[model samples]
Target chain A: MNAIEINNLVKIYKTGTRAVKGVNLTVAKGDFFALLGANGAGKTTIISILIGLVNKTSGSVKIFNYDIDRQFDQAKRIMGVVPQEFNFHMFEKVQDIVATQAGFYGIDRVTALTNSEEVLKKVGLWEKRSSIARTLSGGLKRRLMIARALVHKPEILILDEPTAGVDVQLRFGMWDYLRELNAGGVTILLTTHYLEEVQQMCRHAAILKEGEIVRLDSVKNLNKLIQQETYVITVRNMQPLDGIQSYAPVVIDEHTLEVNLNRDEQLNDLLIKLIQNGFAVTDVHPKEHRLERLFLSLL
Target chain B: MNSQWIAFQTLVRKEVARILRIWTQTLLPPLVTQTLYFIIFGKFIGSQVGPIHGISYMSFLVPGLVMMAVINSAYSNVVSSFFGAKFQRNIEEMLVAPMHEWVIVAGYICTGIMRGIVVGILVFLVSCFFTHPAIDHIGIVIMFIILTAAVFSLAGLINGIFAKNFDEVAMFQNFILVPLIYLGGIFYSILKLPVFWQNVSKLNPLLYMVNGFRFGFFGFCDVSVIFSAGLLIFLTLVLWQVNIWLLKNGIGIKN
Candidate 1:
């Protein structure tokens, strides 16, 4: 069964702002899907509508074969959301937030407490369970949100900008946990500004623009859409190199050069030429990530 | 337990915890204020003005003061709690939950009424050190207490739903609610007022609440107990319906 299906989803605000415009989307069961878009591109609106936080002007949404509006209880029962903002009570204790969320899903007190502890431990927050939520650092707070979202054991998890302000180490740690969760057959619908996150974790992706779905495909297939890729090369010499000017390299500095390569180009040939010309290459890497290139192209 | 039951219980538990957790703010102020009212108005001033209905002045004022504390606590508890939830945007948690609107309203009302009753009981206990006023009608007293709390709790919910900011909330309490309560016959009987002023005081619903509760205490009231109880019931039903409608429409929380 599909985890989520949205058709003709439209949300027009009171001021006539068309936040979402007849967007159709589907996430298969157990699929790790990414919804990518710029700010105000209707990413949050779509998630909000699905979760009943916002009323749709016209549309249909179903989760696990349950209609969102008609069978709201059933649909909402199997879904958990990590909103873009920290919506939990800040004055509340960490464990209470997670346990209360489980209780909201109808779990008994004993089961909710067990689930809360398990999820908190998994998120590395068990040691701080008694501490108030507002005292946690930004990275820990993000993990707390993840724990709260997962405490109920929903079949589908929606994470909207879950790691926005998190540092690199903590961000990657969360990525590992999410990967493990997805591998355990949990469907995850993620929306984030981190292109690297989508590139690493999402198998399928949909990019939205101006309240409309602009691109939807597997990550690998989307990467194939990029006809050219740019690479930044660093040389040992601090002076300009000789020869190989036909490739139209832009000198970033005395020792660095930026080169654009078509999909068919051989990087080894260019490296051999640089070596033959007595320019010792130190490093070479893509200027932009593959998903980032695609995302920018679609935008 | 069922999901609906669990959801309702959890909401109520959270609401109660929030109220009790801030005891200095929610529970203490009412007790202190009521104690002062008993000392200053019921004792010092009442000793000078004497009593009406052939009872001591301090004994006559206890029920009205207790009811005032109940109404204030019930109204403020729901307003501050719910509005705080909205201001912090944490109300979205319940909004996204798979619970009925009535469950949410009931959870809030239960907490508000709990605060009201707790404050009323504390205030009455404090009043005991000054005056030994016996209950004349325990049933009517309990009835009026619950009815008044329910009415004000629902009204507070409505005020919270429409309030956009802290100042707006304060405006409802300061300009509308406080004035109505003070003028609701807390200090003196409406019979002492002139004919026109007495009729004007009757227009305030709080007057009926105070008089009904006073009747419960002394069997003396300016208005009929039946009329006061009927008015309280009618307002409770109307405000409850209005709150349910506001929640169904997603007034201030949804855009």
Candidate 2:
């Protein structure tokens, strides 16, 4: 069953801004799906409409076969959302925030508190449960939101930039937790600016541009659309670039070179040529994420 | 046991917790203010004024002061709390939940009424320190208090829905609510007013509330008890419907 299905969705604000225009998309159950877009690309708008936060101008949205317009209560029962902004009460305690969210989903107090404890422990926030939300750091607050969203054990989790503004270490930690949830059969729909995250964790992605989906495919297939990749190579010995010029190698310093390799070009062939030319390669890595390159190219 | 019932209970629990958690802000001020009213209005001022309807002025002032506390507490609780939720964007929590719109409205309204009754009881106790007012009709007193609180609670929800900012929230209380309460015969009998002004005072819905509550205490009222109670019930239903309509349309809370 599809976790979410949106058809010909349109949203025009009262100011007459057409935020989302005739967008159709679906996220299959148990799929780790990424919705990629730049600012104002209607990513949040689409999510907002699905959650019934914002009224849709036209079209239909269904969650797990429950229509959002006619069966919102049923649809909302199986979906959890981590909004783009922090919306929980700042004055509330961490535990209260999560348990209170469960209550809104019609969970009893005892069960809600039990679920809150489990989710808080999973998110590493059990110790901070008694603290006021505003006292927590940004990363902990993000984790608290994740815990709140998961307290109801919804089948689908929708997160908007869940890792944005988090430190690299914490970002990786959240990714691991999300991966565990996805592996446990939770359908995850995420919107993020971190292209590296999408490349690492998302199986399929859809890139939205100007209120429309411009690309939708598996992550591996999307990576294939990149015609070229730039790599920063660190060498122990400087090479006189004579034979590797076809790769358009640019010398960054005495021991470092930047090179662009076409999709058909082999990095092994280029490295061998460099080795033959007296360059002892110490390290080679892409200067930018492959998905980021494709994403930028699409825009 | 039902999910919607559970949701409603949770909302009420959260609201009650908030009211108690901030008792210094929500519950204390009314107690202090009504104590001052009993001292100044009933004791000091009533000493100079003659009795109305053969009852001491201080005794007559008791019910009005208690009703005033109920009205203000009920109205302010929902307005400040709901608008605060909107301003902080935390209202989205319930907006995205599986509960019906009427559930949201009832949750807020129920809590508003709770605060009103709590504050009303406290003020009545404080009034006891000043004078022993008779409860002529206990049923009428309970009915009037609950119905009055419900009416204002609904009105407060409407105000909260339309309020765009904190200033707008205070604007309704100060400009509209305060004026209506003052003109509702809290201190003076509308019977003392000229025939024309008495008719104008009758138009103020709060006048009926105050008079109906006062009738419960002394068994005397400037307006017919039936008319006052009927007006209170009518206003409650009308305001309740208005609030439900606002929530259904997502007016002011959603875009």
Candidate 3:
């Protein structure tokens, strides 16, 4: 069964702002899926609704086959969330905070304490167990968020910008841990501003623009967001390479030239031109579609 | 079955510990403030001002001072803790959890009550150094204090829900709380007011709490103790429901 199914979801704020406009999505159980969007793109709003924090104006949300709006408590049972904001009791000790969250999920203090210890150690917070939450560094706080989200052993996990303020090295480490979690059969949904994160981690993806789902498909399908292709070529000799007219080669310098491709375009035309021009071609390379181009397209 | 209960207990304990950690700010400040009232209006001024209702003015003012401290601290605890949650944005964890929303609210109110009662006890201890105000019924005074704390804590929950920013919270405490407190028969009995003003003062909810608390001390009050307890219970229930709705609907929070 799909971990989360959002069908024609519509959300209108009480102030009359229509934030989400009929978004439909189905995230398969255990798949690492990325919800991509720009600011004000309704990504966070959508996540909030699924977690039961925001009420939907209309439509349905089903988590693990249970409609969240109709069966809130049961749907919430299987879901865990890591919010983008660092929202926790700052003055409280880390040990108390994590254990309290476990207790909410019905874990006893004894078990909660043991589990909290293991988890805090997992996030490198065991040494600072008694430290106030506010005194933790930004990176440590992010790790703390991860530990809290996982305290209940939820079947489905949602991370909202989990690596936003983290250092470059820690970001990679977090992604690695999440990858391990995903491999362990927990369905994971992530909303991120970093495109490369999506490229590396997600198997399926969606894009939202101005509160509308502009794209939704497998990771490979998202590559289609960029249509035109680019190819770069290097030659053994530099000569009058202008004859490569059919492939539209632009001679960038003495050794390098570039060509843009369409579906019907053939590379033979450029090879024939370069051979005829006495420019011995040594290498021909095609540049794959990049997220930067896709982002620019969405904008 | 007991999971959520444990969660609730932990939340309450954490909240209580937070206030206890800052005992000076949370407990001592009210005592100091109330002592000023004892020195100025109770002893220094009571000597010049004749007896009030056949009792020393100092004895009469003690109940009012105690109730006021209870009301203010009770309301302040909830408003500040919840608003601090709103400010630091930590409340999101509880909101998104699998736990019930009512549990979160109850835990918060419990924290408020603890602060209110702690300060009340401190004020009582401080008052001992002044006039030895006789307690006609210890049970009745404790009951009145609990009811007063409950009602005002619920009111503070409402304020926390509706307050949009820190400035708005300050505005509520300053404009609404301070005026209502002064006009609630704290320093003077409503009996001294003109008939029209006396009738109006009776309608002020704080009047019942203060008068009932006074009944606990001197066994004399403007109204029946039963009536005061009843009024406080009614206010507590009404404000409790309103607070629940405000929190459930995210009135000013999510917006």
Top of the candidates by lDDT: 2
Judging by DockQ against the true structure, name the best candidate.
2
Q: Estimate each model's TM-score.
A: 0.97, 0.99, 0.90
Taking the tens digit of each residue's C-alpha lDDT, what string does model 1 give over A132-223? 99999988889998998888888999999998988999999999999999999999999999999999999999999999999999998999
User: In order, what lDDT does every prediction score?
Assistant: 0.91, 0.92, 0.84
TM-score order of candidates, best first?
2, 1, 3
- Candidate 1 stretches with Cα past 4 Å from truth are A238-243
Q: Where does candidate 3 clash, by residue pair? A: A87-B90, A88-B90
Measured against the native two-chain assembly using Cα atoms, what DockQ does each of the candidate structures obtain, in the order listed? 0.79, 0.88, 0.56
Off by over 4 Å in 2: none
Candidate 3's C-alpha runs over 4 A off are A224-226, A231-292
| Candidate 2 clash pair list | none
* Per-residue C-alpha lDDT of model 3 across residues B1-255, encoded as one tens digit per residue: 575687687678767877888777788888889999999988898789877799888878888898899999999888887888788876777777666767777888888887888788888878888878899988889988998998888878778877768887788889988888899998898898899999999878888889899888888888888998888888878887887787777675664
Model 3 lDDT tens row, A1-299: 99999999999987888899999999999999999989889999999999867888889999999987668777876888999998888888898889878877777778889989988988788999999989999999898888888888888999999999889999998988899889999899999989889888889988888889887888877776566778888997777645666666787888898888764666787677678888888999776445646766876
What interface root-mean-square deviation (Å) does model 1 yield?
0.9
- Residue A63 of candidate 2: its Cα lDDT? 96
